[model samples]
Target: MPPMPARIIHTSIARDWREVYAFMADHEKMPLWASGLSAGLTREGEEWLAPGPLGNARVRFSPDNDYGVVDHLVTLADGQQVHNALRVVPNGDGAEVMFTLLRLPGMSDAQFAEDAAWVEKDLASLKSILESSKA
Candidate 1:
């Protein structure tokens, strides 16, 4: 399967950039936005665990505030591995989030597409939460 390219999602929230960034970076708050996610980061050294309704997996994230990027590795429960990257850029009134979910050697394209769609919906929920909180 071909590696999935970065999917960009943009939205305007009433909250400030700092608040928006903080909300996104807070792992514990993921289930509040992400669908079917039961818990957030479970760290073991540099690696972090992300558990959802599907299964539990480990990933490593290196945050670069200067470049507004996070380098990560997404390892499937069955031993498949994919290198992922996320970049958050400040827009005119809000922020644009880009997620690059690379295709692993044995990963199916259909699964990747499904996951991408879920992520898109998650971001939309996040935008709504942030915008509504400001009102």
Candidate 2:
């Protein structure tokens, strides 16, 4: 059988999927929660340049969709592309947001685990931000 994604991290946000998707679907807003892009983003057409620990990197986020898909591909200064598969699904009155993290080449097992934790933290931040905004 084909291998599954190395890891899938997720969280259920208190806000409706519409609200969650409206926030997450904006690629330019990613740095607010995404640790890797703490310095935020600048865009030109389909390409987005986000400041990274190493340097500025280019990215391409999937176009907004009615179904709440928020995937993206990031290209570092070294020209390596990393695909991040993310989705938001309705769960009752709230939303379930999931992130699929793949094990890339040269990543150690521990590094993969750490990446999952990082995703969890980021998702939690997203949850906090969205839920708080309603206050």
Total backbone collisions for each predicted model: 0, 0
lDDT (Cα) of model 1: 0.67
Worst 10 residues of 1 by lDDT: 1-10
What is the TM-score (0 to 1) of candidate 1?
0.71
Task: Please list the residue runs of candidate 1 whose C-alpha ends up more than 4 Å from where it truly belongs after superposition.
Answer: 1-14, 52-55, 103-112
Model 2 alpha-carbon drift over 4 Å, by segment: 1-5
For each candidate, give its TM-score against the true structure.
0.71, 0.92
lDDT of 1 by residue, 73-115 (tens): 7687877776756666777666666666554455577876787
Backbone clashes in model 1: 0
Each model's lDDT: 0.67, 0.87
Which candidate gets the maximum lDDT versus the true structure?
2
